[model samples]
Target: MSTTSLGASAPSRAGADGTGAATGPLRARRRWSGARLAPYLFVLPALALFAAFRLYPIGWSFVLSLYHTDGMAQTWAGLDNYQRLVDDPLFWKALGNTALILVVQVPVMLALALGLSVALNSALLRWKPVFRLGFFLPVVTGLVTYGLLMGALLNQDSGAVNWLLQLVGLPEVHWLGEPFWARISIVLALTWHYTGYNAVIYLARLQGIPAEHYEAAAVDGAGPWRRFWHVTLPGLRPALVLTVVLSTIGTLQLFDEPFIMTGGGPDNATTTIGVYLYQTGFRYFDFGYASAIGYALVLIIAVFGIVQVKFAKEED
Candidate 1:
């Protein structure tokens, strides 16, 4: 009877140990799965949509670039379209025009934005919210509306811009009819339209900076310019990088203003890569060529983006 009881107790003890071990693993697995999988559950929908829309289109366009057709039915032409792009002077010209805007307009616009942002950050400024709203309102305006408004303002004979020039004793000039003037006009219009936007971004960054820094600078007898260079500018580095990168990309892919106002014209002087792509794909019905241009834009933007990332990281 003693031996029988001991054997039964031994079996019960073994079974309890095994059950505890099993439960421990189950609990650990539940905790591990929850921690690892929770973030992905939140991100999955957005990731799915981005892949479905953006990534898929880019991949599809590249594949389409290898063929010749209106996308109705493509016949494989290999790399012929890309090869043709090498010798296409129009492509180079469009590229040069886009580069000019990137080189010139982006700096001018961002500088103005930074200045305006600094001014708005001043406590001396009255009605700060009103001023900010006034600046940002143009950015939210409909693109088509701005385009039409610009066209009216730049109209050669009676446009507000030319009329103002005439009133100032300057000869009435062809704002959009001439190549150099057309480029300048477009740049000015884009700058006017986007400056407020960049200012708003900079202002947000400026607000986040601790007020103690400025107070300390003042106590040290540092003037505004010195304070800006030492404190404000360092604080603005991130905002500057953001503005430069976004503005560079925006100018590189410039389309609407030129398309609506100059129609890429006065002899294709204002044609940008984006506008050129539109003309080739939609206007001339060359989907393959258009896809090639689109891919080229991706390459250009990638290079600039890489440079910006490097600069930002170096700053950090």
Candidate 2:
């Protein structure tokens, strides 16, 4: 009886050991798999949120563009919305005004930014911090707040700008009233807001440039103008390209200032594509046409961006 019992216990112990040996690798593999998948599991929620909020809306807007939405019912419109865009005078006017800004405001603002960056970076400049802060202060202001402030200042009656002009024996110009002067006010306001932001961008790029390049240029008997042309300009090419694309995009999408300051007013002189899109969708409940406008704006931005990048590369 004792011998049989000993023999039975030894087999049970052997079976238990064999089972642990086989399961150990499987358990280890499961642990390693969990470790490998941990990062993806952690990031899954963020990816989901992005798809739900950002990607889904963009995709839906494109789908919505193909239908006529009149705030009550969505009717199948095919490409009629796009066809309407071709014949729309207000759309053309908005496009023309946008083109004017791209041609005028963007170049002028970028030039001012470049100059401000150079001046601020120079050793001869005193009170660098003060100047830098002053120049960059506008960029920190909220869009709505700045727009209201500018609206107040550019008011035809009882405005500080007109008051100053009156003091100087100049006529109180109708800034936001007349079409020509209204456009001028927009250009000025845009320049005032974005120049410093671009300057800061340029300043950061300027800091990234090596001092050795400047020194080498100087040692090679390159004057300030020559050095600037050969070294500084070349060094700044990347920043210039960046600013061009960004400023173009920003100028194209100008809604707030024009909306708040001019109300796209004085015969739609200041109406940009962005403002037009807003007026179409929200004000008139023409969602389909507005979506088409949005897509058109996107296409225009893409074309200009590609062209600008290619031109910048060709310069290299």
Residues 52-157, model 1: lDDT tens digits: 9999999999987898976487899899888978989999999999999888899899999999999999989999999999999989988889988988998998
Residue 209 of model 1: what lDDT?
92
Assess candidate 1 and give its lDDT: 0.92
Best by TM-score: 2
RMSD of 2: 2.1
lDDT of 2 by residue, 280-304 (tens): 9999999889999999999999999
Clash count for each candidate, listed in order shown: 0, 0
Worst 10 residues of 1 by lDDT: 64-73
- Residue pairs whose backbone atoms clash in candidate 1: none
Stretches of model 1 off by over 4 angstroms after superposition? 1-51, 70-73
Instruction: Assess candidate 1 and give its TM-score to the true structure.
Output: 0.85
Total backbone collisions, model 2: 0
